[model samples]
Target: MPALPTAALQLAGFLMAHAFWTASDLPPGGHYQPQSLCMRADGNRVLNSFDGTNPKEQDEAARAFVTGGAAQWPDCAIARQVKVGTPTGDVDALVIDVVQYGGSVMTVVQAFRPADKGFRLLGDELMLGDNGPLPPLPAAQAAAAMREGALDHPGMDGKWNQWETERDPVSPLVER
Candidate 1:
């Protein structure tokens, strides 16, 4: 078995040891379900930043970590926040209430990230959340969403092919 990264282990610990049970609450065929985009940590500590209201350039959270925050190691944004409620619990566990703007309405997507699984969007394991939790995922799902987006990480074409070889059913969110 692959040695789970410490981050992944911690994340799993957070979910299994700390997180609580919650429902998907989404209406049938709802597009605003929670999303999480978990990438693998290459070396040391994993790094991350959210897209928030802007999709241009990496956000400030990333800058802080990239500028040598805690772990002076290679970092990747493996986890995302999806609020299920007002954040509660100690550092060990938290429930976040997911929020996303749709036609100017901020819809709440109750979601959470699990430690064992990559991401949870509600029904299946997820890789990326649309806005964070309620829906967790495997990384492949997030890749699909990115492909369906207007633009994508240029040098990652080869990466997607590699993922396809490993996982199937890429989400339509990805572009061609």
Candidate 2:
């Protein structure tokens, strides 16, 4: 069997951890549901949702959501921030490196947009190698690659199964 990259392992760990965390942290009167990760056209931000009700609030909420999830892993820390050009425009991303566990440097990339309150989390990626600056591919191309990769890999399916099984059994919210 081939060994998975450190970043891939870290991403899988994050998904598993997130499943458990979200299951326990369901919103008041809301069912437990995991949000889909999304990247903006500019590639500067990714989000679970942006209903446009309140951009600032939404951004802050996303940041808190990511921060809380990342905090669960004591070994992970922000490595650096970089700006990448996208089809829409340039965006900033945070590179988080997880050390002390797998013995290899694992990096997760997160992008954020500035809000009135502060910076809000936009999205993240699990980088496997020295892929240079993230948002490495253009937004559309990156999204397509992600879709293709998820569809092509049985590992992704296994990860989803693990996420579902390890999570608490509660009704999930209907996606809009």
Candidate 3:
């Protein structure tokens, strides 16, 4: 979509503004302790979807999404669509999985759902750590689950972090 570039800019600006990599909530050793940064998307829709089986467009989107200082770091993110098993229907959800090393290996997952023209953040962003009992693609799985219907969406699957409630946490928290 024409707004793909705008989406990229929004994402990059969002990430840069948030500085999730240096999050104070991360446990030491970069271990996998599944955690979530609970937030509600304010209906800030992105006017495009990286909805192809091939990851070329998704990869580029991921690269563009993670920009500024985070961009300086190596590519620690992937873009892909997860076919979600939903009650209403099967929906292909756009997900970006990012692994950042601050004090811990934090895998950040952002899931988006089909809006009018493009997509919007499903509900909230999820983060899982280095050593956890989750599937290898915990981020993807979590993102897909986000689109499974608007019930009790697990922002972090019971591993709620105090950081989520912080006033100055992140964006897309605004509900439509």
Candidate 4:
């Protein structure tokens, strides 16, 4: 086993960790599962799974990422007591759940807005997996697949069986 790529970016200029409130916390939709980062990406709604089983869900997701989607949306915000992870912090370990549709092999999404000061739409912050046409796996399996290249092991399970497969939509889509 090796240190997750997140550790490599502790001092990364792009690092924007909010905080760690809890483990196994679920996001808005049933699809986006809870992890270290509550991000603005497609599978974020897919519950961390880059699956396209539900087109309606994914469509809303795709537009969101391309058009400054979710990050711009504002709901009556609730503060989560997140333990912001840092390279020099007391937290010995870190895990950034990468989830993007058409970017790197590490599952990351691009988060930004049209104007530097305007609100972004939550829908525009999400994009489903790209690169190769693929299917969705259960949430647990999705997390495992994300760890493939970056880990000594990169494997996932199907509905009820362990599976070995290639990971794509691994990185976040780069904006122009």
Candidate 5:
């Protein structure tokens, strides 16, 4: 059988996780609202989907979320791929670059694998700027960084705030 598109599978897993987390409503401190899914020009949906007044309006909002309803640069794309050695095994990693019109670009590095009837998000890092085509680091170095919890880099700060977000529970690329 053919494998599913990596991007779609990963996004679906992410959306599912978001849904699970929101529904669980753990910690009970902050407001947790479910997100809405909308397709983008690149055939991908917005990461932060939200509820809209109506289905049609929600669709429009999703479209506008990516384009701002104005002529802009093309949608996001998978800039590059890299291989990393994880505890489970060697896996393919992807670097996704999203360009926001009239705003800064957001880069995401994530490692995923097909699991639990879908996909599992092993590790992810978000950063600002167009840092496409990031070369894969040496396996030894990558493993060391993962062990040391050294995922964030200096001078890469932006609104997304890599430092603020929690790191993945497990190091997907680190071989035990």
Candidate 6:
């Protein structure tokens, strides 16, 4: 056997890497969804400069905060906003959805209220798999939606199962 040339070895490695990446169901950068690449949060806390008077500013601020939060999941993440009619007015509620390689999709549903400064975090819930884009709604409507399964997270219905077949599970807890 003879030693391979350095250039040939490097080219072979590069080709293998490229092939593995191209064959996977990941974004080009193997980081996140291109559509979800909005303004990232400064850190864990999202400070929006919006005055809450203008709808456009409020939406921009909300999206920025959501994107920042979703940044924790570098592999793949998405943010969603849902309008819930409240007694005061309509508010933009945000959800951060993240899916890791060979893991279940996780979601963090959050509700925020406008504060004197910017916005105040009201509450958030962690849900397994694309279970919701749930916004703060009336108790009756929320309950009924949950009961009737009307609130099932839309899209990517069986895509996870397909991915499972293509890749190994991240952990033993993942569905077999």
Candidate with maximal TM-score: 3
Candidate that scores best on lDDT: 5
How many residue pairs in model 4 have overlapping backbones?
40
For candidate 6, lDDT tens digit of each residue in 131-162?
A: 44433343223223222321122343543233
Q: Candidate 1: list runs displaced more than 4 Å.
A: 6-8, 12-59, 62-67, 70-79, 82-121, 127-176
Error of 1 at 70 (Å): 4.3
Q: What is the C-alpha RMSD of each candidate to the true structure, in Å?
A: 16.3, 15.0, 17.0, 18.7, 13.4, 21.0
For model 5, residues 76-99, the per-residue Cα lDDT tens digits are: 222233456755567644443333
Instruction: Point out where model 5 deviates above 4 Å.
Output: 1-82, 85-89, 101-104, 115-118, 126-168, 173-176
lDDT by residue (2-94, candidate 3, tens digit) is 111222222322332222222323343221111112111343322223343454554455444444223333323333434555555554333
Point out the worst 10-residue segment of candidate 4 by lDDT.
73-82
Compared with the true structure, what per-residue lDDT tens digits does model 2 show for residues 1-176?
A: 13333333333344323332333343433222323232223322222432335434544443444445444332332233345576667654444343333233344554544222232344334344345433444423333333333343333535434433443332111112
Against the true structure, what is each candidate's TM-score?
Answer: 0.22, 0.29, 0.29, 0.18, 0.29, 0.28
Q: Give the 10-residue window scoring lowest on summed lDDT in candidate 5.
A: 151-160
Local distance difference test, each candidate: 0.27, 0.37, 0.34, 0.25, 0.38, 0.33
> Whose lDDT is higher: candidate 2's or candidate 6's?
2
Residue 95 lDDT in candidate 1:
21
- Tell me the TM-score of model 5: 0.29
Name the better of 3 and 4 by TM-score. 3
lDDT of 1 by residue, 23-142 (tens): 222333221211222223443322233344442222334333322342432212222233233334311112221111111101121133332443333321333234432233333333
Clash-forming residue pairs, model 6: 41-68
